[model samples]
Target: MTIVRATFLDTPTGETAMGAELRAATDAALRVVDGTIVERGAWADLGGRHTDDDVLDLRDGLVLPGLVDTHVHYPQVRVTGALGMPLLEWLDAVALPEEARLASPDYARAVAREFIGGLAGAGTTTALVFGSHFATAVDALFDEAQRVGLRVTAGLVVGDRGLPEALLTTPERAYAESIALARRWHQSAGAGSSPRTRYAVTPRFSYGATDALLESCQAVLKDVPGSWFTSHVNESQAEIAAVARLFPDATDYVDTYDRHGLVGASSVLAHNVHPTDRELRLLAGQGATVAHCPTSNAALGSGLFPLRAHVDHGVHVALGSDVGAGTGFSLFKEGLQAYFVQQLLGEAGLPLGPADLLHLATRSGALALGLDDEVGDLSVGKAFDALWLRPAETSPLALALRHADSASEALARTFALAGPADVAGVWVAGEPVKS
Candidate 1:
């Protein structure tokens, strides 16, 4: 058992509505045993209560819940800045060919090491990642994640057509391989039968999926309890047009997945930047969550997401690095990007606060992945998936936060200036993975 003493911040109850109260605790202490946080409160209070536990004092630093990423491509790590081609064209030019390289087992393992190490260095403890086309590559990814002790929910990218021949797979092969991988790793345990990973049913997107592929994806999710489904939707003008042309029978882009029984509470769809008002309503009604990949959207020239509208409609939204389309893997930068794009939308944007942005990067993404109960916040019964931020004296963020009179102001400064350099440590399941 261990007791961590630190200044803590998290949105314990989930996203705060605009101008609503944000949940935060200062000078906090967490009591962790068997990889789960058993208690949390003001440091003085918990110190008195848990005197027997070993201590890791981070009292001079800030401890935030480990960031949760809703959408990131494991195979697209190296091609981030190949810019200006929008969605379809960019995929054709660089994304596909780069992803295809993972077909080599050795190359896939090497990239997996880089990708998982990058996530740890950026302080992301939990992520819903898009995996490679090759099942062996996906195997390498899961193996590396376990070896590094990060919480990853990932799967093979299933595509029947509209992708490179090297990346394509028949619907039958997709179903067999996806389900087999799930059987091998989904809800899998370490030595104690305590689960540290999950499997998602992932089809590349509307462009790569035929009706047969999507139905097979639905089967994988249904056949495996606690599994999830994720894919892209309404991301760019050209992608939307092509999807519309491809699926004329469907009413809209969101409908393309909904008709296949894929939209629901456990499913996560990325980049609803161009979703119609009706689609937003359907998403909210169906309890589906959207991963607002603002960096990727802006990078690909995808439209600004309707942040305020989604909030007004009660749609659940989370942040994603969408790495490759997104320039980096840091969820803090993703938070900043989300705020920047919404600000670009003027009055259409929500009354965003730093706490809201933090929540989007952590709790909201955890909720979207159905792991909110286990990893989202610093609440009791949650695992100690957390990041420690220690601002250097020479850093401007330190000076700015020093004068901030409120928690909100200080948190905003943290997001504005605290890049990967400020992350002093990272923990997953009560154990340090980065320090």
Candidate 2:
């Protein structure tokens, strides 16, 4: 068995903060055998013995469940921070052109490596990613994620309309390609003892997919149980207008997906900035999740999300970077932006606390993507995907948040506050990936 000592916080029951905190001034033992958290309570458990195997001495620093980004576009990593513009114009000028480059297998592979590395560096262990349209690009992303031992759910972007011809896929071809990719990746053990890599059925959005294409994408779920379905919803005013013009028979944008059987427990819809009460209720009733990309919303002028409304209505809400459009891959920054965005809406008249932000980044995100059972918490039986945080010596959580530097600092300061630079180490499964 292996033992590591640190100040640990595990979000038991997925309610945000740890119901309890375990602080060991000297040392606390962590038992890991065969890549599982065997024991993690008190130092004297297991015969008062400790093994030298991978003992991470976090000192007084914090150890929490690694951040999980519920929504992000891996192919848009290169387009982040493009000059601000509305959704359609941004897509035309920056987003689409940058994503189109992924057609090159070598380019996709190279970017995949960097994208995964950025996630680890930002303390995100698990993510629901959106890969580029090319099947080879999607394969390249999966390969890189598997090599890095990161838990990722990604899919080939299905866009048949309103996009460059090179990026379009017919309804029939989109279904076939998605099914083949799902069969190849979505499982716990593939070929041998290799860990599972999930595949999401990603229809770029309502505007880009026809009724036939959307139905075909959703139909794949019948064959692949537990597969995730994601798409953009109610993001921009123009997109909503386009969706309305495209599906006039449907009640709203949400209904368009509902007609295709795309709204369900395993569905993840990003940017519900303009979702109506009916749509929110549908999402809640169907147990679908909405990934709140506050930064992207602000960057693309996509109006603020009704976070309080969503939470009050019992919708499953999680955090996302929404990269390129959302800007920044750091969940820490996203968490702070989430708080500010909500505060602007006067959410309870107070900003979200660190625990609230942490919840959205961890358990809530995992639940949104339907991976709560495997990740999001550091329970005894859960996978040891965690981030080790070392706060500056001057502060012990209190001082960090009080003196925030950047918007990202405002969020990271709440947890560690030193910055991403203070992220001392990251571990996926039971192995360390960064330090």
Candidate 3:
């Protein structure tokens, strides 16, 4: 058992009258036993009771739940700044070509290490990573995640069309490879237990996947009972127009996946930047979650996310740092950009508060990935997945934090000014993953 003393801030789990309010614990102690938080209370009480237990003092800064990334591409880490091109053009000019290089096992292993390091260094403990087109590369990703102990749900990215020939796979081969990868990495423990690394049936996007390939993706999900599903959605007008032309019978971009029964509670579709009202309704009714990749949307010149419309329609929303096009792995940047996007939309935007930003970055992502029961907040029953923000004393963030007027203001400033450099420490399941 270990006891950690810190000033922790997390969003409340479940519904409450205090809606979107942050749960703050100043000078508090958490008793963690085998990675799970067993006890939490004021330090004065828990400290006196557990006098002999090992203590990890983190009072030098604020502790928050380890950030959760709902959508990020594993192969695109090296191409983050290949910007100025729109979505499809960016994929052709930079992203896809880089992704194809992962076919080399040695290259994949090296990229996997750098990708995992980038995530942990940026304070993300749990992520829904879009895996590579190559099965061996996806295996390398799971291997690195397992070695590092980060919670990752990733799988072989399958597409039968609209991509380079090297990245394409037949439907039968896609099914076989996906099932094989899922069998290997989807569960480290016995069946029904949540493993640190799981599988997600990723179908690149509607324009890239044919009806036959998507059917195989659905079959993979059916075979693996608890595996996840993720894909790109209405991201840019040009991409949407291409998808519309490909699937003439489909009503919209969401219909292309929904027609194949791919949208559901287990599905996480990224970048619904131009989702129609009907698409939003279908997503909400099916209990699917949308990953709002704010930075990528702006960097690719995609339109502002319809956050207010999604909220009004009861669609679940989570933040994703769509790295490569997204700028970086920092959730702080994503949250800040989300705030900026909403502000730029005027009445069409949902004015977000500090609590809202925090919730979206952490708890909202956990809920989206169906890991809320295990690792979202600093609640007693959750895993001790957290990050400590201890900016250098001479830095502007530190000086701003020292003179902040309130906890909310401090949190706002954190979103506004903090970056990966400010993340002094990060832990996942009671194990220190970064320092």
Pick out the ten consecutive residues of candidate 2 with the lowest summed lDDT: 17-26
Residue pairs in candidate 1 whose N, alpha carbon or C atoms collide under 3 angstroms? none
How do the residues 359-409 of candidate 2 rate in per-residue lDDT, one tens digit apiece?
788988888876777778777787788888775566555466445554334
Using lDDT as the measure, the top candidate is: 3
Q: Which clashing pairs does model 3 show?
A: 80-324
For candidate 3, give the lDDT of residue 81.
Answer: 91
Off by over 4 Å in 2: 14-28, 44-47, 51-54, 188-194, 347-351, 391-412, 415-418
Model 1, span 1-435: residue lDDT tens: 998988788887745324434566777788999889998777788788778889999966688999999999999998987888788889999899999999999999999999998899899999999999999999999998998899999999999888899999988999999888888888852242227778889999988889998898888888888888899998888888999999999999988889889999888999988878989999999898999898888888888888888888889998899989998888888888888887878888775788888888888888888888898888899999999988797898888878888888888988888788888999998889998
Per-candidate local distance difference test: 0.87, 0.79, 0.92
Q: For each candidate, C-alpha RMSD in Å?
A: 1.8, 3.7, 1.7
How should the candidates be ordered by lDDT, best one leading?
3, 1, 2
Task: Give the best candidate by TM-score.
Answer: 3
What TM-score quantifies how close candidate 1 is to the native fold? 0.96
TM-score attained by model 2:
0.90
- Evaluated at residue 29, the lDDT of candidate 1 is 80
Q: Tell me each candidate's TM-score.
A: 0.96, 0.90, 0.98
Relative to the unseen true structure, what is the C-alpha lDDT of residue 104 in candidate 2, on a scale of 0 to 100?
95
Which ten contiguous residues of candidate 1 have the minimum total lDDT? 14-23
